[model samples]
Target: MVKFGVLVLLSAIAIGQGETTIESQCQVCQEENNVYCESESTFLRMRGAMKLGPLSCEADEVCSNSGNLCKKKTEITNEVLNVCGANCQSCSADRKYTCVSRNQAALCLNGQASSTIIIDCGEDEVCVDDDDGKAFLCVPSCVADYQKLSVPCSSAAFTTPTPAPPTTPSGDNQKSICQAAAVNKKTLYFFTYADSSCRTYVYCERSSSTSTDFTTTLSGSCSSPNPYFNTVSGKCQASVPDNCESEAPST
Candidate 1:
């Protein structure tokens, strides 16, 4: 939150028979306040006893911790950091967005909910509470039941193995998948593994509306913490739904 203040100074002098008073005006910024980003390019923080700035970040940079600190867009994690331009919302104790609808979730920032930002689940996906019920995550269409997706697809649930390729030699088979999407009038499609591993996904895009053929743009696994492709926001997210396989615990 942004805070504003007015500063006043006064002095009095006494003469033999009269007295005079002097006053001055200034602005106040507390030194102890935590730094926060006010926008993508600007931030406000304390410098000494005065408010520093809603200062501008350099080109290719965005605000982060202290107002003086800025970083490249690729250096920061979108889901974890309280960076500017995240469109944070107003939220209290429960920071997670409850499903506004079966397919939609609210976007939050710094424990506050954004007044306007909401995420819609992708095709064949639905908004559901995560395993701990501490947050909401978009899960597959087959998982509408209240029963948690606790069971792993295989018995070796605790091991972290390299993600296996799709069951059908799917990487060599982009034409069929892309054609299917094109037939449905969709120029773009994102597909996860058949095993619900949540580690890898594929992205395909048609060249044009007239084109029956498509190209694969990305086929890879997500990074740590956000090892799952969230169908709701169409981005990598931190949570691993119960239906998805879990990584081996760090020794």
Candidate 2:
């Protein structure tokens, strides 16, 4: 047979606080001002019953302290599971499309869900986080190349009936000069027009060991009117021509 005990506090304060009574089979000590002496023991037993061990014990008199502790524990457990989950792998999508993890899927293009394809790239591969928290496909290299088209007119050409400049290089054309000098040899570079002409200047540096690997390859033209390099994404961007920009230039 098990023993039972009913402990009752007859104080008016206890009655008003609804803490006047406690029923249990174990030894329990009571305190004034609505405090319970054996509260830790009761809480430990409750946690044990739930298979959580004594980790649920509170460190302060208020329940908020215990709640915070439990919440922190839950967060740690979740982080471990997410990073080390059995299905841990890279994800991919189509051209002009991107994908990220479910937790970060909102950051994807137009806040859409990531595609189901899992890329085989390693963790070191470059990637972007969509607004939804999903990691999207990104390029790994920093260097890129693009072809430009242009038709130049000479200053000496027809004032009233001047003929158009030759379609080919004339040994004095700026484009031919740059092409002969190989000024655009560098892989990662940015180009922009000057004086509203077809002359495009490039910005770049020699590759080094610490170069940054760009992740996303944007197809649209940059909206800004200047050509500048983005250090964070390692890409060169132009302000004109909508949607033809490459991924960030490599550092």
Against the reference, the lDDT scores of all candidates come to 0.39, 0.22
Candidate 1, 20: how far from true, in Å? 70
Please give, for residues 126-189, the per-residue lDDT of candidate 1 as tens digits: 5543333255555665653333331111111111222222232244544554454344454444
Window of ten residues with lowest summed lDDT in model 2: 143-152
Best by TM-score: 1
TM-scores of the candidates in the order shown: 0.25, 0.16
* Off by more than 4 A, model 2: 1-104, 107-177, 180-199, 203-222, 225-251
Backbone clash total, candidate 2 = 29
For candidate 2, lDDT tens digit of each residue in 1-251? 12112111112111122222111111111121111111111111121222111111222211111222212224434122112111111122422322222211112233232333233323222222222223333322121001111001111111111111123222233333333323434444222221222212222222432333322111111123434333223233453333224321121
Query: What does the lDDT come to for candidate 2?
Result: 0.22
